[model samples]
Target: MKLQQLMSQTRRAIDDYGMIHTGDKIAIGISGGKDSLTLLYALHGLQRFYPEKFDLEAITVDLGNPDFDLSHIRHLCETMQIPYTVVKTEIAQIVFEERKEKNPCSLCAKMRKGALNDAVKKLGCNKIAYAHHKDDIVETMMMSLIYEGHFYSFPPITHLDRTNLTVIRPLMYVSEADVKGFCRKYQLPVVKSPCPADGYTKRQYVKDLLRKLNLENPGVKERMFSAIINGNISDWTPRIR
Candidate 1:
């Protein structure tokens, strides 16, 4: 998708779910990946003319991997004039080496988020933007069902009472295919994940399964997404404008 198309879908999602507010400071969690970079571009473009004025801060939680490079990401941020920060941590060594976790995604994610939240708080951001697209939402629901025997997925907006911070997913309406297309078309400085278990997790299995299901049963993914929207699962329902 082109930038114009991405911004249009992103603005619609933001408006439909009341994701943004006046004078809000949102921290975009950058993983140097396509999803997050696409989010970065979308928000930056939206900030230009959205009725509600808000500030954007780009942040990445470095997982202490030597092979994980952020030079290109930093340059992108510099060129875009978005304030960027990278929080360095030993999460990589702790999760893979020290802990020797067979399933490290869970622990790695926890540590990464914890670090990112702390940095965001220090930056005085009231909200955080996560680049979780439509496929992520559906895949997460499937994972919950198959692994935990429940039908659940994360909401577009979530308020954390403990931290007094809100998390918003602005890319909830955009598909993974569109995200890849946007990145490719824009030639985004996408960074490869250095994690050993990038594609060997249960989530990966569910993603593959979902793809097969969608192929055999057309519109299955859309129906599942519709169910989540209308299922009254937590705050999954879109807010009325």
Candidate 2:
């Protein structure tokens, strides 16, 4: 996907969901993956012409993995003129070594988000942007139904009363395939995650399952995505402009 296409879809999500406001400061979460990097570029490009005139800072929660690296990410941020920060944490050691829990994804996510939230607040950002896209929305809803027995997915905009911060998914309209294509087309300096449980998590299982189902029933993914949009779940509908 070209930058123009990415920005166009991002603007649609931002406008439909009432995400950005004038003078808003947003911290873009960077996981060093293609998705997050793609989001960083999208938001950076959007900053150039969006009416809201928001400021952006890129942040990452370092999980204390020996192999984890952020040099390329830092340089990318520098090139884009986006300030970058990395909140250091021993989350990986605590989860894999100290706790030794069989299911660590949930705990790890909580800890990482806590760190990220604290950093965003310290940095005085009122909003944070995640890299979740169209594929993640459908997969999450599927995971909820298969595991917890109900229809649920990440909303485009969520206000956290506890932290007094708003979370927005501006890339919600972009597809994972498009993100991959964008990354390859631009030669983005992608960073490989060093997490041991990278592909062994439940989300990966759901992603693979969705891919197989899509293969068996072509266009099933799109239908599931459509269901998410029209499912009438609380806060799923876009805000009226």
Candidate 3:
């Protein structure tokens, strides 16, 4: 897709969700992965001259990997002057040893989300944005349906009760391929997750499964994503738009 088309989709999501309000300080959760890095870059590109005045900062939850040199992130953040803070955690080790039987994905995501929320509160930001895109949304829907026998996926915008933080997914309309292509075009420094379960994980299996399913049924991802938006989610929340 053309860069203009990609930007248009991203812009639509941002506006549709009313994310990045004026005079707001937004913090992004960067996981050293393509999705996150792409998010950081896209936000940076938009922040250059966003009509609305706001500040952007990048935060990464370091799994405390000895091999992970965060200098790249530091450099990028410094270049953009976007306050980049790293929170060190032993969650990786804990998850591996303690949470072996249960699905580690749910726990890992919750912990990371807790950490991100804490960061938002610590930084005094009213909102937080994640890098989830079209593919992730579709895959999540598939995962939930196949395993939990339910139709559920991430929302484009949400407000948490405890912290009252607005979580927005700006790249919700963007594609994974476009993100990777944009990263390559911009030569964004790609950082690998220090998590030992990087490649050998059930999430990877689900990703592969989704891909195969899509290959068999063309437009499967597109239809699934659209269904989530236009489907009967009225019972899930009164805030359904």
Candidate 4:
């Protein structure tokens, strides 16, 4: 049931967003974390029987952290029979030194994504996928509304205006809990970000708050997800993927 839900949600997101087309090659960005790992698994499953066939390449952006390893990721990709590419980038040092801020989350994320996009393009993929899930969408909506003085969140599909490349978030409708469960069930080898910041950053703060709220009101995150998906802010348009 869990796997079905995960796959169903992902396929619906992909079909609804037109993320991939016949004969197109896509880059699935796997960070070796649970979310990205699950994304690869889901895509691998989809590739098994997708009528409109497409090629998928699993790519990981190595942050040049000493603790980072592509061995486990490589094995998983080989087990799934998908090719893997690792991009070497000094993102950790760059963000730590050049980003003179109390928190380097924003800059680090941007740099990592930019590096991944560039690498994917060079690797012959015009479409890229990220492993952002339901919780991420809700948290981003909350952050935008509370901090940015407006309501906004990541879209299911969009073209990076500057690069004219398409980005897809197939896990948009799936929950992070489901992802963790799926990873455990499959015994997927997981990797962690080896930095002091690790997963204890500001996003975790919001996630913790949401978790506590969920204890009292389990409907909170669901409501947030619905609002983001069903609510409209303005006439701001989106370019189709």
Candidate 5:
């Protein structure tokens, strides 16, 4: 997908959820993955023309993995004139070495997001943007259903009262396939994840299962996404245009 197309979808989600406001500073959580990088590019592009003015900052929580590099990411942010900050933490050690939890994803994510949220709050950002796309939304819903016995997924916007920060997912309308295409076309500096549980998580299982189900029953993903927005689950309802 081209930058124009990405921006179009991102803008729709932003507007639909009332995500941004004039003079609002938004922080983008950079995981050094394609989804987050695509979000960075999309939001940067949208900033150029979107009527509601906002500032963008990129923040990454460094899990203290030796293989994880941020030099390329720093260069990308510098080239785009966006402020970038990486919070260094020994989360990898704590989760893998010290705690040694069998299911490390939960603990690791909590630590990572805690770090990210702290950094974002320090930066005076009222809202933080995550790169959860259409596929992620569907996968999360399926995971909740299969594991927690609930037909639910995260909302596009969530207010974390504890942190006093509102989380926004502007890429909710963009698909993972389009994210890959945009990254490839724009030659984004994609960084490979060094986490040990990269592909061994329950989400990955659900992702594969959803892919197979989609193949067997075409348009299932789209219908599921449509159902999410119209399902009246929490704040999934879209704003009237």
Candidate 6:
């Protein structure tokens, strides 16, 4: 996808959810993956002309994976002129070496988010943007229903009262496929995740299931997204335009 298309979709999500306000300092969570990098680029583009006039920063919480590298990511951030920070943690060692938990995704996610949140707060950012897109939304709702017996997905804007931080997904309206195309088109210096459990997670299973279900029932994904938007789940409700 072109940068113009990306900014259009991103702006829609932000406007629909009232994600940004004047003087807002937002941190972009950079996981070194296509999605996060795409988010970083999108936010950087938005910073150029967004009326709210928000500041941007990029952050990555290193999981202590030896194979993970941030050199390319650092260069990209420098080229964009966005402040970048990497918080080092032994999350991989703790999860895979010490705990050796059979299911590390949950624990790893919690620890990673905790580290990212703390970093964001310390950097004086009131809001943090995640890279979750349309595909993630559908997959998460599927996971919630199949695992926890609930019909739920994350909202576009979430206010974490505990940390006084607001989490926003500006890519909520953009599809994952579009993000991949954008990364390829722009030659984004994408970095692969070094987590051992990268593709062996429950979310991957749900993602495959959603893909098959969409193939069997065309427009299923779009319908599911529409349901999420109109589900009246309190948090899912967008701010008044």
Top lDDT: which candidate number?
1
Q: Give per-candidate clash totals.
A: 0, 0, 0, 0, 0, 0
Candidate 2 structure quality by residue, lDDT tens digits, 3-77: 999999999999987899998999999999999999999999999989899999999999999888799999999
lDDT of 6 by residue, 51-126 (tens): 8999998999999988888999999899999999999999999999999999999899999999999999999999
TM-score of each: 0.98, 0.98, 0.89, 0.92, 0.98, 0.98
Candidate 3 — number of clashing residue pairs?
0
lDDT of 4 by residue, 10-99 (tens): 888888767768887889988888999899888888887877788999988888889887798898789889989899999888877666
Residues forming the 10-long window of minimal summed lDDT in candidate 2: 232-241
Model 1, 69-130: lDDT tens digits are: 89999999999899999999999999999999998998999999999999999999999999
- lDDT per residue as tens, model 3, 82-121: 9998988877777877666355666787888888889878
- Candidate 1 matches the true fold with a TM-score of 0.98
Which candidate do you rate higher for lDDT, 2 or 4? Answer: 2
Give me the displacement of residue 103 in model 4, in angstroms.
1.5
lDDT winner between 1 and 4, please give it: 1
Give stretches of model 5 more than 4 Å off.
Answer: none
Model 3: which residue pairs collide? none
Least well predicted 10-residue stretch by lDDT in candidate 5: 232-241
Error of 6 at 117 (Å): 1.0
- Quality of model 3 by C-alpha lDDT: 0.79
Go through the candidates in order and give each one's C-alpha lDDT. 0.94, 0.94, 0.79, 0.83, 0.94, 0.93
